[model samples]
Target: MAAETSDQYETLQIQYPPSHRRGPLPLPPVSRWALGSVLAVGTGGFLVLGAALAALVTLYVQGQAELREARTELLAAGAPLLPPNSPRSPGETPAAAQRRKDQLGRWLQGLALGWRYHQGSIYFFSSERKRWDDAQLACRASHAHLTSITSAEEQEYLARESRGGTYWIGLVATGPGGSWHWVDGSSYSSAQSFWAAGQPDNSDHGEWGRESCAQIHPVGNSLWNDHNCNFTFFWICKRDLSGP
Candidate 1:
């Protein structure tokens, strides 16, 4: 009976497979090392990608700052930077330049005041009253100067267009008893003068001889008068379309 039991045990041992000798199957040593290597390679690649993204972000920020500084400098130099598609050729056609000028003049006139066009020039009338100095400043802000009358014909035309309203002109005395000149630095000539009779008396009864600024008074055929520079009145702004 002992020999029979020993023979049965040997048969059972022979029938068991070599793989089932252990409790569970285990990975080869090479495969475990390869898996760790792959994880390390992936971590290194992620770090490289993160560094590249940071560099790109810094470059973008610096580029924007440079663009802003360039624009500021251009504005300071009075050289307006137009869009890429704008007329940039140095030898622009006269018709094209005139069209651009007219378009810009129309846009400016439409912004704050109504305008009248005559002889390649645009005249804008102020909607609100302002002092002579304020009016001149406003005109300059609009890329214009206060109206400078050179002829009786021109003065008559302005008076007609303005509908007989009291308005300031560009004529102002440079100093006490000084010569009169237009805002454009042109000397006011007696040949083009349109003063009203007994006007520019330099009355000191109210504000002294400070009445040095000229105005196109509505009374007595729309003639001009030298009034106080501080007096508030409507004004005219004129811009030449042919000007650069």
Candidate 2:
């Protein structure tokens, strides 16, 4: 009976594989080192994937911020995202918003105040108390001088713009009723005199005698009056380059 029992046990042991043996079994290797290596490889792959995803996210955010800054600059320069006739609101679809922004950006590039290439000449207008000498000195510091109306066209243009205010011109009589000369040493012969009636009287004010300065005042008709230079009035300034 004992021999039969031993033989049966050996037969049962042959049917089942030993724990250390491996074949086409569903279970993996039981070695802790092997298991740890596999787990480490899996963790490393996961970390690499996480890093890639994080980089993608950062790039997306930076691109979005740059686009927003460009849009804001376009809007601040008096450019609107949508035209008055557009049938879209701020709450509209993404397509509509993008279209509006593009349209406005194109329009802003064509504005006159957008940018200037060159400025003509510097002109000045002042209300502060300054003698003719002082005024000329101030203009020189700015690399400019009192205005000189060189032609009839310029005179007419100035008369129209000056309106009714008395402003200084470059023409001044060095000697009583002498040849009028510009501050830049140019003769006044080129100018078409649009002086007001009874101008340059040079009335004696007891202190400095008659007025030595030349001024322009546009009455009902667009004409200028040579007044005392001592009078304070807002002057017009011209820049060799275009103005702001």
Best by lDDT: 1
Question: How would you encode candidate 1's per-residue C-alpha lDDT over 1-244 as one tens digit per residue?
Answer: 1222223223221111155585776855678688899999999999999999998887656544544454455445554345433664476675755655455544443332445556546688888888788899998987789999997788888889878788989998776555689996556897779988766655442423346788887766778877767657889988754444
CA lDDT of every candidate: 0.69, 0.54
lDDT for position 48 in model 1 = 100
Model 1 bad stretches (over 4 Å): 1-113, 205-209
Candidate topping TM-score: 1
Worst 10 residues of 1 by lDDT: 8-17
RMSD of candidates 1 onward, in order: 36.1, 37.2
lDDT of 2 at 239: 32
Alpha-carbon TM-score of each model against the true structure: 0.56, 0.44
Angstrom error at residue 144, model 1: 0.5
